[model samples]
Target: MSGLLALLDDVAGIAKMAAASVDDVVGQAAKAGAKAAGAVIDDAAVTPKYVHGFEARRELPIVWRIARGSIFNKLVILLPVAMLLSVFAPWMIPPLLMLGGGYLCFEGAEKIWHKLSPGGQGHGGGDVIPEDAAHLEEEKVQGAIKTDFILSAEIMTIALAALPESGLWFKAAALGLVGLGITVLVYGSVALIVKADDVGLHMAAAGRLRATRALGRAIVRGMPGFMTGLTWVGTAAMLWVGGSIILHGLAELGWHAPEEMIHHAAEAVAHLAPADLRGAVGWAVKAVIDGALGLMLGFVLIPLATKVISPAIRAVTGRAAKGH
Candidate 1:
């Protein structure tokens, strides 16, 4: 009886530790996910276009396929790579983060450059009409999954960087949480956005209540503008987050002038604001500075990426650029 009681106590203790570890993983995952919000938002914003022009019944199914791909990208691919980096080459994280940050900056800058330049590359949504129904669906799913892989890589790196020092298992658990949680959040949101029009149309056509019908009409009418707004927000976030990461990374690498200058300037600006608003003012000022820096860096990188990197990618992959 004594031995059994002792064994039971040991089992209970292990359970308690396991529960505590789970809590830690959840808490860390949330923080890390928030830190990657810029990419997360962009992921959510970009995915809906993949389902465009599909049949109403097919939209959710398409989103489901993309969601499954996204999960595979994050959990199966990114999570293990992140853990390996953590264990074997922790020092590589900073440079890798800066690389991802630069990519974000470049992406945001390229969009802006396109907008300002005459006949800049247009943001092409999927085919307005499928060229070959089955093939087109497969192509769109492949493209979306590829894009998700890039964004998922960024998200995982950002999450890994944000994590506090912990055991390898703990870090793995936290990243798994971050990966799976973010994939679901992003694709779940995409599913809703894609289906919202159908939902609205149904409500508009069938709702018995006048207000309900009106609300449905509003939703249908509002979606285009809402998506556009979301795009702009995502772009801004990319710039802000990218620039901030680069600045911090540079500081970590022993170049502190930009970071310190931005800090002092933000403090000065904050001091002029009312007490209640000082923190917000400071953060806004810093974000603006970071975004400006990101835009500048992105502009610098544009020629290199286009002239050199794109050609290399094409050579290696045996694929031409998609658009003329």
Candidate 2:
């Protein structure tokens, strides 16, 4: 019947619309995820340390727990907050982004400063090993989750800022997709990094072929250097992304000199390159400038943070706790 034919056409049209919407969501999520690459990379690089010294069997479980906490942080807590900001306080996004970006720069520069400074305390030091291993594990997991909340906040905010102007449901869908996708990506990479050595060992010991054993040995030998490389890469990414964010935020807030100067400098540098490579060269130059600026800003902030901000915060919290 004609009626049945019309219904079929209508259903097909609806399906097409649904498919387009899904595509849009996926595209937006990818863009948003890319925008938060610095935080995401740092999350992956930092998480493996929480599992350090744990029993092999327990490593994945701890990662799983942290991943779950991360999901909760993004989806349950941060997502709604981001939505509220978008709805009610959209003007706040740039400032919040710059704050988060400053944090990234500080963290990156701090790592470098510690590396270069004499008698500097490293992250691995000063742990009071409790008698209860289980308690210690729990404490580490909680600590990691707490740390993740900050990074997750940055990631979600960056993603939200990156999203195009759209309806509530569309933004929500993109954010949810971004959160879930990023969690899976970060934790999945962490799992692999953590277990690589174990897998290598097993392969070395039990591999049927000589080549397999040799490859496994190579993996075991290579893992430490690989981790160190990952850390450095993460640090660099943080600086680059953080600096870029701050510069963009400043431009958005009506200070255009920094961005304009950088652009002109990049163009000048790009002129020397072949046309095909000019874009890439220009981008690299801009990123380097941004990172350099970020490092300077970070150094300026370091003393302020260590001497003033930290002490002030501790004092206030101390007073509050005593009053309570």
Candidate 3:
């Protein structure tokens, strides 16, 4: 019948639209995820350290716990908040992003400060946490989850900010895609990284070929240094990305001088390099400038945050007496 043909045609058209929307979501998610690569790298880099002190048997479990926590952060907390912001406080995205960037800068700088000033309050990252049968795994899990929440917040916010200006549903789909994609990328990589040593050990022990066994032994030996390198690289990334975000946001809000100056300075540095190295040189110079700014801002915040802010916060919360 003619009516049946029309209905079929209508259904086909709807299917085509759905397919197109899926493509759009995928496209936007990829772009947003790419924009968030620096944060993603830092996330992957930071998580491995949390499990370092654990027994080989416990390492994967801890990573799994953190991965679960990261998922909860994005789905339970950030996704909803992102939706609300898209609907209600769209105008506030830039400022909130800048605030997150400032926090990153502060954190990255504080690490440098603590390194330079031996008497500074040392965080657990510096401690030699030993693995004991009597250890409270639950507490460590909680600590790691809390840390993941902060990093996840940064990732989700960056992804949301990078998303294309689209309709609410489109934005939601893209963000969800981004969140799911990033969580898998980060935690999946963490899982592999944590288990790599075990795999390397097995290969080293059982490999029939000398070359294969040698490669495995090399991996086992190389992992510790690789992880250390990743940590330092992650710290640098946090400073570079965070400071760049703040500068870019300031420019968006009408202060362009810092950005312009940095650009010209980077260009000047680029000229000192051969053509092949020009782009790499420019990026290095810019990253150093951004990191320096991050360090300065972080230093300024720490004293004020600890001495003035902590006491005020304690007083407000009636915890001043407990400071003893």
Candidate 4:
């Protein structure tokens, strides 16, 4: 009886420890998810375009399919690779993150360039015809997955960096939780955003109340602006996160010029503002500086990506131009 009672006590202790570990993982995963907010927002923002030319009925379905692919990308593909990296070659992470950061910078910069130079959308097969409706949907979904792979890699790396120092199992648990949580948050929001117009249309047509119909009309009108705002926000986030990563990377590697300059520059700018507004001013200045730096780095990288990397990728993958 005493031995059985001791066994029960041990089991209870294990359960307690397991519960504590679960709590810790959840908390750490939240922190990790927050760290990857830029990639998360960009993921959601960029996905809608994939469904743009499709039928309204097809939009949510395409998003659902893409979201599924994104989950697979994160969990089945990236998760194992991330775990292996952590186990064996953890030192390689910063360099890999820098690479992803550079890509983000390039993307953000390229977008700005495209906006400035109307004809510059010449890269990335913007000229190609959609083969058919089904083919087009497949093409867009595939493109979304490819893009998700890059952004997911960035998010996973950021999440891994933000994770609390722990055992391999704990780290893996936290990362997996972060991955799952972020995918749900991102794609779920995408689903809602894509469906908002339909919801508004239904309400506008079918609602019993005049005020409800008015609100629905407002929603339909407001959605376009909201989507545009989301795009700009996503772009800004890409720059902020990408630049911060690069700056942090340089600081890690002992090149503190960017970091110190931004810090003092923001502080100097903040001093010009009233006392209560100083903190907000400082943050705005710092973000602006970081984003500007990111844009500059991105601009530099875009040509290399287009002229050099694209050709090499084509040679290696042996894939022809993607018909958009």
Candidate 5:
């Protein structure tokens, strides 16, 4: 009887520890996911365009394919790579994170510049024979998956950087959770955005009440504007997150001046705000400053990326620029 009781107590203790670990993983994953918000938002924003020109019936299917690929990118590929980095090259994480941050800043700034410049926009897809719908759909899915791989790499790296120091297995679990959760959040949102017009149409055409029909019509009309707004939000988030990461990286690398300056300035702004809103005000001020810094860095990088990097890649690969 005594032996059995001891065994049961041991089992209960183990269970309690396991439960606590699970909670820790969840908490860490949530925090890490939040840190990667810039990449996540951009991923969701970019995905919808891949389904454009597809048949309505094919939209959901295409989304599913891309979502599956995103899962593979995050879990099968990026997660293991992140784990390896944590184990073998932990010191590299900060620099790699800064590189990713710089890339995000460049992308966000380029988008803003394009929008502001006259005739800067170009439609996706170069001239080609009209391939079969099935073939074209597959091509788009492949292209989207490739794009997701880059974004997923960024997201994973950012998440990895954000995690507190921990055991290898614990870090892996947290990163895995972050990967899976973010994939679902981004692609699920994409699916909804893609199918919204269909839902609106059904409501507009079939709603029994006039008000319901009007609401549906409004939804249909609002989706385009909503998508455009989302793009802007994503750009702003990229700049803010990217700039902050770079600033933090510099501090980590023994240059604390920029970070300290930003912190003091934010505190000053926060203190001027109403007591209840101080924290929010401070965060917003910091974000704006970071975004401005990111924009400046991005502008500096644009010519280098376009002239030097693109040409070098093209020369090595003997292929045209992957502009998208």
Candidate 6:
């Protein structure tokens, strides 16, 4: 019948529309995820340390717990807050992003300073080891979650900023996809990094073939270097991304000189390269400039944060606690 044919065509059109929407959501999510790569990489690099002293069997469980907390932070807390900001306080996004960017710069710079300074403690130091194993584990998990909240906030804010204007539901779907994908990626990577040594050892001991055992030994040997490399890469990413964000934010706020100068400089560098390589060269130049700027800003902020801001915070919190 003609009526039946009309119904089938209508259903097919609806299906096509639905498929297009899904594709859009996925495309947006991928772009947003890329924008949050610095925070995501930092999250992955930092999480493995929380399980450093734990039993091998417990490492995966701890990672899982932290991953759950991270998801809750991103989806339950940050996602809604980001939505509200987009809906009501859209103007605040640039400043908030700059703040988060500054934080990344500060953190990256501080790590570099520690590496350079004499007797400087690196990551995973200064953790108060409780006598009770359970208590220590709980403390580490809580600490990691707390750290993750800040990073997750940065990630979600960056993603929200990257998204194009759309309906609330569309934004929510894209953001949810970004958050879930990032969480899986970060925690899954952490789980693998933390357990890699154990896995390598097992393979070395239990592998059926000489080649397998040799490969296992290589993995064990390579893990430490791999972690170190990952940390440095994460730090570099933080500096590059943070500096770029700050520059872009400043331009958005109408102080365009810094960005313009950087752009011009990048162009100059790009001109020396072959046409095909020019784009990549320009990007690299920009990244290097941004990272250098971030390092300088971070150094400036270090003393302010350590001597002034930290003390003030402790004083206020101390008084509040005493009052309580």
Could you estimate the TM-score for every candidate?
0.93, 0.96, 0.85, 0.88, 0.95, 0.96
Question: Residue-pair clashes per candidate, as listed?
Answer: 0, 0, 0, 0, 0, 0
lDDT values of the candidates?
A: 0.91, 0.93, 0.83, 0.87, 0.92, 0.93
Q: Residues 1-324, candidate 3: write the lDDT tens digits.
A: 999999999999999999998998999889888766657787898778777656788888888887888888888888899989978998888888888788788777776777678776445544335554326567777887888788777877888888877898888888888888888888899999989999899989999999889989999999989987786677778888888889988998999999999999999999999999999999999989998897777778888878998889978778656765
Q: Please give, for residues 149-217, the per-residue lDDT of candidate 6 as tens digits.
A: 999999999999999999999999999999999999999999889989998999999999999999999
lDDT: which is higher, 1 or 6? 6
Candidate 4 per-residue lDDT over residues 1-324, each given as its tens digit: 999999999999999999998999999999988988778888888887787766777888898898899889989999899899988998888888888888888888887788779686444434224457888778889999999999999999999977876899898889989888988888899989888998999899999999999988999999989987997788888888889889988888889987998999999999999999999999999988888889989989988999999999987676554441
Instruction: In angstroms, give how far residue 239 of model 4 lies from its true place.
Output: 0.5
Q: Ten residues in a row with the worst lDDT in model 1?
A: 315-324
Across 1-324, the per-residue lDDT of candidate 5 in tens digits comes to 999999999999999999999999999999999999999999999899998877788899999999999899888999899999999999999999999999999999999999888987756664334567888888999999999998898899999998999999999999999989998899889999999999899999999999989999999999989999999999999999999999999999999999999999999999999999999999999999999999999999999999999999878676445432
Model 2 per-residue lDDT tens digits across residues 193-254: 99999999999999999999999999999998999899888888899989999999999999
- lDDT score, candidate 5: 0.92
Each prediction's Cα RMSD?
3.1, 1.7, 3.7, 4.0, 3.1, 1.8
Of 3 and 4, which scores higher on lDDT? Answer: 4
Candidate 6, overall lDDT?
A: 0.93
Which structure is stronger by TM-score: 2 or 3? 2
How much is 156 displaced in model 3, in angstroms? 1.3
The predicted structure with the larger TM-score, 5 or 6, is 6
